[model samples]
Target: MTELLLVGIGTGNPDHITLEGRKALQGADLILIPRKGPEKSDLAELRRRIVLQSVRDGMDRVVEFDLPVRDPDLPYLEAVERWHDAIAELWAVTLAAHPDAHSAALLVWGDPSLYDSTLRIAARLDPTPKVRVIPGITALQALTAAHAIPLNTLAGSVEITTGRRLRDTGWPDGAETVAVMLDGACAFETLDPDGLQIWWGAYLGMDEQILSAGPLEEAAPHIMRIRAEARDRHGWIMDTYLLRRTGVPG
Candidate 1:
């Protein structure tokens, strides 16, 4: 049976890779990098850079494959599930092509245990390869570090949710602070903005990183404008933010 290593590379920073993650990459017989199309070519390039920096053996074992796109016509959950199946099948085909490779690695953007679905897709592999995960810094960590702020206020809780939920369900009941992820839409604009403060970051650990913070009312428009400009410039953007109700002690 093949061994599959899911190594967390962290957000756009080579140094964010843990020693364990680097070791996993070096030891793997094959490294699979997914190409997410022209709009996000930088992502694949970043992974390639990380692999070259980590592995001493060169690119002989490295392989690149096109990532499957989720169908817009299908329901969200169904589309994700079907897309995952296609990825698993592709993985099997790629691995089968290299009979001698007993260990293969994929560099995950953040910890697989977080919002990532790599582990779920790996479970679909027929014959089920032995999966190993090497944890790395998460975007939340990078965001908090970049802003020099604590993730949670003193003696308070932090709720993590998506932009869709924030827009549809409003603030989670009784959550003093909420961390929003995968928010392409500025869902914060939907909120009342009263008694709210926001800390936002995009491209969190990279040179192109952008940050905005202050009362949600005052910062919302600025964040939205910059987010649009950044997305237009790069063709893609990954951002997360924390919204805290005022009156919470630091």
Candidate 2:
């Protein structure tokens, strides 16, 4: 039976790879890396660097596969389901091609347990494969670390949500600290921002990282402009943010 290792490699920093993740890379018979077109070429190159550094000799089989793009015509969730199925098929084909790949490693961005769906996709394999998950730094942690702020207020709760949820739900009923990830729509604007503070980071822990924070009212415009410029420059952006309603009960 093939053992599938979903290894989290952190945001974009090579150093973010944990010691256990490194060991998993070395132990793997083959490493599967995804290429997300030329616009996101840097992502693939970063994975390449990690694999090159982790594999010195003896075990030198790292394969790259083009990731399937989600169809925009279908509803978001449905498209994602179809995309994951295709990705699982790709993984199965790749694993079949490498007979010696007893333990295959898939380099996942951020922690697989977070907003990422790699683990869900892996479950779609025809024959359920044994799984090993190696955790790494998540984008939320990286965002907070880059901004030098704690994710949650003193003994306060933090709500992890997406841009879509924030837009739909306005503000959560009880949570004071909200960390939003995978927010392409810039949902921060939907909030009142009267007493809210926001810490936003893009391409966190990388050379092109942009961090901005202040009273949400004041900093919102700047973050919007910066996020737009960064996305334009890089053709893609991965960002996470922390929002706290000031003066709210903890």
Candidate 3:
């Protein structure tokens, strides 16, 4: 039976990798790194550097696969589903080619549970590989740590969700802290800016990271500009943010 290990590598910083994550990397017989073309080559390079620095054994085979691109012609959900299916197929082919390799690992950006479909794709394999998830620092954790702020207000709760959910559902009821990710459009513009504070970060934990926080109204424009410039320069951008209601918890 194929054993699949999904290792969370955190947001772009090599140091953000946990001790357990490093150990998982060292233990893997093969490491699968996904390439999203030249536009996102830096992402693949970062994972390579982390392996070079963190793996105890230097010779562990590292494999790269071209990531499947989502079709723009299809609806968003359908496009993503198709894209994930294609990725799963590539994974199956790679695994079959390396039949001798046991304990294969895939380096996941941030945690696998958050806005990432690696786990779901893995589940679709023919025989269904035995999966193990090694958690690492998530983008939300990295964003909060970079700013030196607590993720949740004292005695309050935080709601973690995606940009699409936020845009469709609006502000979550009874949620004082809302974290939004994978949002290309500034969804904050749809909400009431009054009494709302936002902490936003792009490329968290990376050298080129940009962080800003304050009233949503005041910071939204700056976030948009920074996001645009970063995407233009890098051809891609990964960002996350936290929104908090103005009033303190009682």
Best candidate (score: lDDT) = 1
lDDT of 2 by residue, 128-213 (tens): 89999999999998988998888888888889999999998998999889999889989999989898989999998888988999
lDDT of 1 by residue, 65-182 (tens): 9998989999878998999999999999989999998999999997898889999999999899999999989999999999999999899898999998999999899999999998
Give the Cα lDDT of each candidate: 0.93, 0.89, 0.89
Candidate 3 global TM-score: 0.95
Top candidate (TM-score): 1
Error of 1 at 101 (Å): 0.6
Candidate 2 regions exceeding 4 Å error are 248-250
What is the lDDT, from 0 to 100, of the residue 188 in candidate 1? Answer: 98
Q: Per-residue error at 178 for model 3, in Å?
A: 0.7
TM-score of 1: 0.98
Candidate 3: minimum summed lDDT over ten consecutive residues — where? Answer: 54-63
Q: Which stretches of candidate 1 lie over 4 Å from their true place?
A: none
Stretches of candidate 3 exceeding 4 Å from the true structure = 56-60
Residue 227 C-alpha lDDT in model 2: 92
As for lDDT, the candidate ahead, 1 or 2, is 1
- Distance from true location, Cα of 148 in model 3, Å: 1.5
The candidates, ranked best first by TM-score, are 1, 2, 3
